[model samples]
Target: MPPAYPRSPRRNGVHYANAAMTVLLGLGSNLGDRCDNMEKAIEALAGLPGTSLLRWSTVYESNALLAPDSPPMWDKPFLNAAVELSTSLKPLDLLAATQAIEKRLGRVEGERWAPRTIDVDLLAYDDETITTPELVVPHVGVRERAFVLAPLAEIVPSRRLPGTSETVLQLKRRIDDSLPAWMGVVNVTPDSFSDGGRWLKDDKPTTAQLELLDGNYIDIGGESTRPGAVDVDSETEWRRVAPVLEYLDQHFSGRLLRPKISIDTRSPTTAARAIEAGVSIVNDVSGFANRAMIEILAGSRCDLVLMHNLSVPADPSNVLPHDCDPLAVLRSWFGEHLEILERAGIARERVIIDPGIGFGKSAIQSLEIIDRARELMEFDCRVLFGHSRKSYLESMTKVPPSERDPETVAVSANLARRGVEILRVHALDLHRRFWRVYQRTA
Candidate 1:
């Protein structure tokens, strides 16, 4: 089980003063032009009286519902989506409206999970928990269905279930691994190799960049760990990172969109401060070698990323020995460190191991690790590959950092196929969409 964080008052979709409630609706169609059906459904939803469509999720293709006793022809794939709306209409009334839309869209009275032209379910109405013969607020199917959870998680990840402690994103993480967790990168420095100084203005994280890269798990780094990058003291590092943390805390904490935070720092002091600031993950590029850092991690519930780096700031000249097998070296390093972490009382499940793509590897070594990533999964812990626009790609194509997303996507596709759990990348949207399509198509 993941460690628990303190909860704030649950956010409601309903605006009591105006008697309007925020509502979540699930949309699906396995019949007709599915995409067209979804768009028409959205139009009908927005056209409903006293209701304005707020936002909708991407149309995800999922296998149609089926059972042993069901007809074989019902196996058509579904284009599914979730939508948010605000309305003064009561729950039953809104449900009735959705049903009307389904009826008009060619849905006929049918058996449970039967193929249909469209299906619109009343997922949640604000924080209202309602159960009746006709409806249940936070539809019971929401918890277990990936088809529903994927789209809902896209738009409203931080919103808690009407009566449960779990948020949409939390539930998705618990049950679904069809997609990898996307960790957006925020490098708060002027000297990082890629996209450095783009997100920073006056030595602080700009709101524009933070908003642009908003995601469930965001990795914030003060000191760049890129090869030959200059180092800063703990205070200086924290100074660069604290603003992003503060910005997130002030603007997002305890809200419907609060993101789980990660601090990418090697300094134990910086990691400790980040934990105090409510970060859930400490991505120590130095692999928690410091007894002080291990001690700090031992006492906290924050997840640890034990990355294998040859040296901090990445000594390019210090590449792995040519004769030694890179995977063997990684296995040895991970075994030793994981044992150290286990001795210190951190759970194996809470640790994510990174082979440190370009940190200390030659281009061939990096390619070897990428191709053989599945071998690293032997340790019974999640594996992370931070191969976002690094120099290793230059061995294939000599593009600058800004033009490396396609290469990043290609590598990410390979990692995803190998069952890597998390991908730390510069291009979050591109990778996310690519993977979504990949999963749907495959």
Candidate 2:
């Protein structure tokens, strides 16, 4: 197990004197009962022991900025408002109190882009600059997010960002707030067809795993659903992934921008455990078939990657549905399954379709999905293509999985050009470097 983390600010040597300071907070909600949720949070905020509401901004409705790289689906337009308050609690404690309100209002931390009942963002704290691993005084996204600023400008138009002369209005008009999504793959199984066990250290992410996963999003898994792979029991799967989630919550708790943690498991038990441990996205190969699985997402805002799968039983023996075009079949599968999710209260905008690249595919079938992914866009949600280091690439390039970095990059570049919303990958470093180069010169 990783080292235990101190659970309190005082233990970490941060002093929150019995001092009261005026603060700015941004409130938002998109999930169930949006306005009511915001009102509930407002009431809770005013009721905080050391806090008194001074002023609030007009509520604004804006499209959710789904972070660039990982789009399980689109996000609902958020209703946002900012408020000014005087609080006697320290900054960190104030944060803790706001988070408690979020939890009380049934907001479960899942994905970075997941909608919620209420979101309380600490925009600023009495002009006191704070830069710690866990908390930054001026919320990092405040400048770039027009949703935050439009409402903030309503209350305090002349507010300045920490360490900057620009007012909120100036920063809002001058910032490029596009946050790209990067999907970093983490497999805990010993037998992933490609990089199985490569990133695991004693069933938890090693130091190397941590270094490579220092990106925007992480797709974590316990079982390897490779071709002809045997199923591990749900208990075993939960055990493997739970510790990884714990490591993320403990270690990355202090980063300025934390990766949105995702759990790539089909078992409802494992998925629920991951959700409890702060995972936001579900990469289920079973296509979220069971009500138990969908119910795990009930009342909580979580992202779902509903990939197409037929399992190892139909693995390329050509004994499967040879009747019609596979692409049409997959599209029908999406239409039917998506309707099921919608009826079950899961939004289409919160689901990304992956046409199961290697699960029951020939190299040709996988390539077809890659070449013609937008057709699957008929579901009206973002399409994700997870062809990262799969056997189909080997079928095309005849190289070992480890040596397929160039091939993987080629696929990713082509997909980006073709408008794929997200690309899942085992090696984030190579793609990240290539992306940097392309951005510099493109």
Evaluate all candidate structures by whole-model CA lDDT and list the values in order: 0.79, 0.71
Q: Which candidate ranks first by lDDT, i.e. highest?
A: 1
Q: Mind sharing the TM-score for model 1?
A: 0.66
Can you write out model 2's per-residue Cα lDDT over 1-442, one digit (the tens) per residue? 1111112223222222223788999988888877678877876777777666665644445666678775656457677777787889888899889899999999997987877788988989998989988789798867778678756653465567778897664554454431124578878777777776776656654534565444556788888776567888998887777767777777765331245677898889888777766666788888887789988875456678998877632265542254457688788888999888888898765677888887666777778778886577555565677888777786678788877888988888767655465678867888877865664445
Name model 2 segments beyond 4 Å from true.
Answer: 1-180, 201-207, 312-314, 318-323
Expressed as tens digits, the lDDT of each residue in 345-393 for candidate 1 is 9877678889999888998899999999989977766678899998888
- At residue 423, what lDDT does model 2 achieve? 74
**Model 1 alpha-carbon miss at residue 267, Å:** 1.0
The C-alpha local distance difference test score for the whole of candidate 2 amounts to 0.71
What TM-score goes with each of the models?
A: 0.66, 0.60
TM-score, cand. 2 vs. native: 0.60
Alpha carbon lDDT at 15, candidate 2: 27
